[model samples]
Target: MIYAYIAVMAITTYLVRALPLTIFRGKITNKYIRSFLKYVPCACLSAMIFPSILFATNHIISGAVGLLVAILFALRNKSLVIVAASSCVAVYVTELLMTLI
Candidate 1:
């Protein structure tokens, strides 16, 4: 049953990732659509990250720490790799301290 669940999730995830590229190939020439597509990944990432930052326990302190780290990385013009790594470290350290306390 667990294997079946994993298989189903894997298939669904693959389809979601592939469907857009497969269906939209050669169909996204519009300038506005192209502009919107450029922002989609950032918007999606923000939506995923923001909730944890905003509403997690110790909201203000944790969120501020994460936000500050993110902004610092951004200001440094760091690559996404660096930004993501730094943010993960910040969140992990914060959570660890929370657990310890």
Candidate 2:
């Protein structure tokens, strides 16, 4: 019974995802649609990042500090690596300070 349920779920998932590509193979010529699709990655990335960053450390203060540092680096148009490292460093330092205090 469990095997049957797993098989059914796998088939349904595959069909749901594969059917879209099979149906929409042609170029999407609509400018608005194309523009929307182009920004999807950024939207998706933000959706994935925000929640985890909000609660990444033992204290909320560390998380907030990390987020602020990350935003500052991003606003300055720093490289992705630099932004990430700065955020990590901020979080670590904040957490360490919280521990000492």
TM-score each candidate: 0.64, 0.71
State model 1's lDDT: 0.83
Tell me how far candidate 2 lies from the true structure as C-alpha RMSD in angstroms. Answer: 3.1
| TM-score: model 2 vs. ground truth | 0.71
Q: Give the range where candidate 1 is weakest over 10 consecutive residues by summed lDDT.
A: 51-60
lDDT tens digits, residue span 1-101, model 1: 99999999999999999998888778678899899989999999899777666666465676768777988998999998999789778977987898789
For model 1, which pairs clash? none
The numbered model that scores best in lDDT is 2
TM-score, structure 1 vs. true = 0.64
Q: How accurate locally is residue 84 in candidate 1, as Cα lDDT from 0 to 100?
A: 73
Clashing pairs for model 2 are: none
Q: What is the alpha-carbon lDDT of model 2 when measured against the actual structure?
A: 0.93
